[model samples]
Target: MRTSANPIIADLRDRIQHLEGSVARHKAILPFGVPEIDAHLPGGGLAYGALHEFAGGGVGTVDGAAAALFAAGIAARTKGKVVWCLARPDLFAPALAQVGLHPDRVIYVEAIREEFVLESFEEALRFGGLGAVVGEVVRLPMKASRRLQLAAEGSGTIGLMIRRWRRPTEVGDFGHPTAAATRWRISVLPSEPLPVPGIGRARWLAELIRVKAGESADFVVGACDVQGRISLSSDTADGSGETRRSVHSG
Candidate 1:
């Protein structure tokens, strides 16, 4: 009998290695820092080197803006420059700052076509030193999504996909698989009713529609604190004085 050829021992070694790799991938996460939300995620945060998707509930509604801000706030938590591969010129820098993504740290790539946007996003994700990468697209095909996921894995950059649809019906396409680690849907909620009659901080219905690991969930959260950190609201009711400055940000 050969010395190192025992099938049982070899199988055990392979299984251990697979488990270790899976743990490593899930452990490198940037947490929301909110206990309520963190408890839902398997690793207590958003996974680095993985793609996450977010979209508005519908078109014509301002909820799309809310979704974009949520993604931006997550991106802001990254350490280096953020690559925003967008198709439009209408992104408001000041509004982004309100959610924690600063103007100076953003590297915007204005792509006129959806394909261009995806290409730019994948390229940026493959770049070794970036903090994060965000791309705007109405629909993300499975093939392109797989490539983006691989690029993020290779570079260790967090990827955020913000969906923007010209037609309201296209929002349904977001449910299709895209190899993303997590999927979120953001809808604008009425601001908190203050003690007085004035407007309170913005609130949002944040839904975790899909998760690669752990159970999916939802939250009625206020808004991001500075530097892209989220502060969750316990009740869906009144106000909390969070998500300051821009209502679109929440």
Candidate 2:
């Protein structure tokens, strides 16, 4: 007797195999440069399919820029795919490049309106090809944040929400729901005295205000630039040393 071949069955089996491979690939998680922070987070780092928010207001612009640079460094170590969604078109490309992010690996999308910014952010997160997606938005509603969270979960990519502040209350209040895995507040620290002159070092105080896996409110992690890239500071070493090293980056 001759056997009959079913094309529908074969196609279904192929798709299932493909999906299984995808799931297996997603088991690997990306780690932020800070070990203490990563230890507090689920999966030892920022989970691939999760949304994280960076809140900034009292910190000022320098700290905000440092936060962006920090996220860029994390994305650079990834599979080399990143999308920077900004409300202003004139974002200093050179500044980002100075922080070790090659211009070629970055995609910049400029959206002037807040609504447009959030819409573009959602679209980029849904694209699924990027390793990480970052958005600088002034205000985001809980409903909208939930939608973005779902999109990130579906895409298996990291989503960074940098909340810009127009007023004092804007800094304290982020309208996101409980769905966010981690939330941070970043501010620039006063420059410490260095052995060498004319070369200034950057420092930031990152407060883990909300985290699902660990404690909530005021877990400060010191951050600084190491060889032009951002990483967590070493608690053992003094602020200024001839050689700089990152405490964690695995």
Q: How well does each candidate superpose onto the true structure, as a TM-score?
A: 0.84, 0.75
The models' CA-based lDDT, in order, is 0.82, 0.68
Task: List, residue by residue over 36-70, the lDDT tens digit for candidate 1.
Answer: 77766767989898999999866754888999999
C-alpha RMSD of candidate 1:
6.2
- Residue 28 lDDT in candidate 1: 85
Lowest summed lDDT across 10 adjacent residues in model 2 is found at: 241-250
Candidate 1's displacement at residue 214, Å, is 1.4
- The top-ranked prediction according to TM-score is 1
Which ranges in model 1 have alpha carbons more than 4 Å from their true place?
1-27, 237-250
